[model samples]
Target: MDTPPRVPGLGTFLDKNTGTPKPPTPQLVTVASRLLLLAAVVQVVASVIAVVYAASPARLDAIQLQIDAMTGSTPSLAMMRNLGILTVVISGIATITAYVLFALFLAKGRSWARVAAGVLALLTVMQLLGITLPEGLTTVAQIVLGAVAVGLCYLPGPNHFFATVKAARS
Candidate 1:
């Protein structure tokens, strides 16, 4: 039996059970990937700033004084400083990893990408909650960015993309 040639104006409806047309990349997924990348970059910058803040003599002195006032006995300022530095390094690496994975998901259309992004966003929210800012600007920014990151994954475009991918896969 011979198959008729597809018409030029007609759209290609791929067989649900076979590999066919290239899957479309949704705008929301693209936005999500970019957001993750931006987050990673910001995290790196913030981490560097954190390390500088932790190592500054003035900051250390302030911390030491606070500790003395609280406990009435001096704690090792060096230990506190080292711990702060360690936190900065660890957080930066985590941010970078999340960014890389999210970007990969966008490029390769992986289903697990959103899961990783969600986890990272959750961690970021938790971290923001624990920090005390001198003003409300940082808190506001954190809330907005975190919301956008999570929101992107749930947007209609990405949701459709995932659905199509799932249907095609099965």
Candidate 2:
């Protein structure tokens, strides 16, 4: 048995080099992985767009006004601008990182990736109500693509594939 302090997605589960060839990944898993990757790409573009939009004078003023209304005080334009940009950029980076990791592991037939991807997709869809235009459209597309991708990983073929992967990993 392994030691107590093991990370999940290391050499054992991902790209395990058993002398035996792995069964070919199912088409559904392949599609799901690719779709997730595509969604990550779209998310990257949207994040960049958001960063630019968030930097706009009108946008910064709106943020300042909203904060002032809520708290009766407003931070300097530079501070608020930096925070606004940082907020979206940091969020985008974290999400893009997750998507890439999930996609890679999903391609490797990691069942947990499917579940995580599903959760991410669900959360993305849930935020649809608050999304704005331009970047919002891409966010919507990313959500749809992510949902479909995660859904594919749950289909019969991929279900069996993930099970087999689990067996091999053990």
Candidate 3:
């Protein structure tokens, strides 16, 4: 029988005789891609929701009243509403970038993608601790949800989920 191809840097990861670096198994890539796609979908939905709220004056006033009551802030409702909307927009951009990079990493095996994912995971934890923990009950629920998001990304489905993509690429 004929021999398989060889990958230059992989040594014998896939029989040394095989000439192409074995592409990341399709199943793993698909899992990672889907995670990223799901994140993108959630972010887009949230952005749409924010846009709806931003456009509705009555909705904005109601939200502002609640916030003002809670924080004892005397600022006008319009200012508070603008701040909230701006936060949503900024978060949307960051979310889109994260999902896009994650999908790209799964497909192309970029090292930076691995680093970025790890950093994002850590940020998720920090945000939970820094912003959520102090707020109690509702914040606790948000922290749990954030933890799940980070946890899912590192699970076994995403081939070498926590490993160095550069090494795999090589």
Candidate 4:
């Protein structure tokens, strides 16, 4: 009796009948991809809201008041506003990059992407907290969507999907 060929470093064997990689990606992973994409969109919206509201004079004054209360020193409004803009732009870029890039890799059935996405989901919440008021709606949407998206990948079906891909690729 002959055994199937094996990929290096993977416990998975080639399909006995086809002598190739495993089957196509499962539906759960596909849904995860879509959910992640939706979350990415919401993040983009929230970033725009942050830029708009974080730049407002009243918002800056409110932030200044908080800073004064905490540190007892007030910086110039222009400096504070510039810092806010820089923070938003850098964070927004990083968040969106992680969401979209990891989602794509997850869709492709990358095993590492599954773990990376979980980390991204957690980190994303920290960023969402910085969103300005009224942007809270989008932030909440991202939380829900991102939670569900990452959760789905850990389901049995997706696990199998990822394992097959791993064994096949490895």
Which candidate achieves the best lDDT against the true structure?
2
Off by over 4 Å in 3: 1-24, 55-59, 62-76, 111-115, 118-165, 168-170
Reference-based TM-score, model 3: 0.51
**CA lDDT of every candidate:** 0.67, 0.85, 0.56, 0.79
Query: What would the per-residue lDDT of candidate 1 be over residues 125-165, giving only the tens digit for each residue?
Result: 66655576643234345445546865777777777787776
* TM-score-best of 1 and 3: 1
Query: Over the stretch 1-170, how does candidate 3's per-residue lDDT look in tens digits?
Result: 99877657554222333454545544555555555556566557656666666758777879767876875547777777778788879987887678676666545544345456556545544544544232333334333433444444456654363343435434
**Clash number for every model?**
0, 0, 7, 0
Off by over 4 Å in 1: 1-22, 62-76, 130-143
Better of 1 and 3 by lDDT: 1
- Order of models, best lDDT first: 2, 4, 1, 3
Which parts of model 2 are misplaced by more than 4 Å? 1-17, 67-74
Question: Higher-TM-score candidate among 3 and 4?
Answer: 4
lDDT of 2: 0.85
Deviation in Å, model 3, residue 139 alpha carbon: 13
True-structure RMSD, every candidate: 10.1, 3.1, 9.8, 7.0
lDDT by residue for model 2 (53-103), tens: 989988977977777776556577788889889999999999999999999
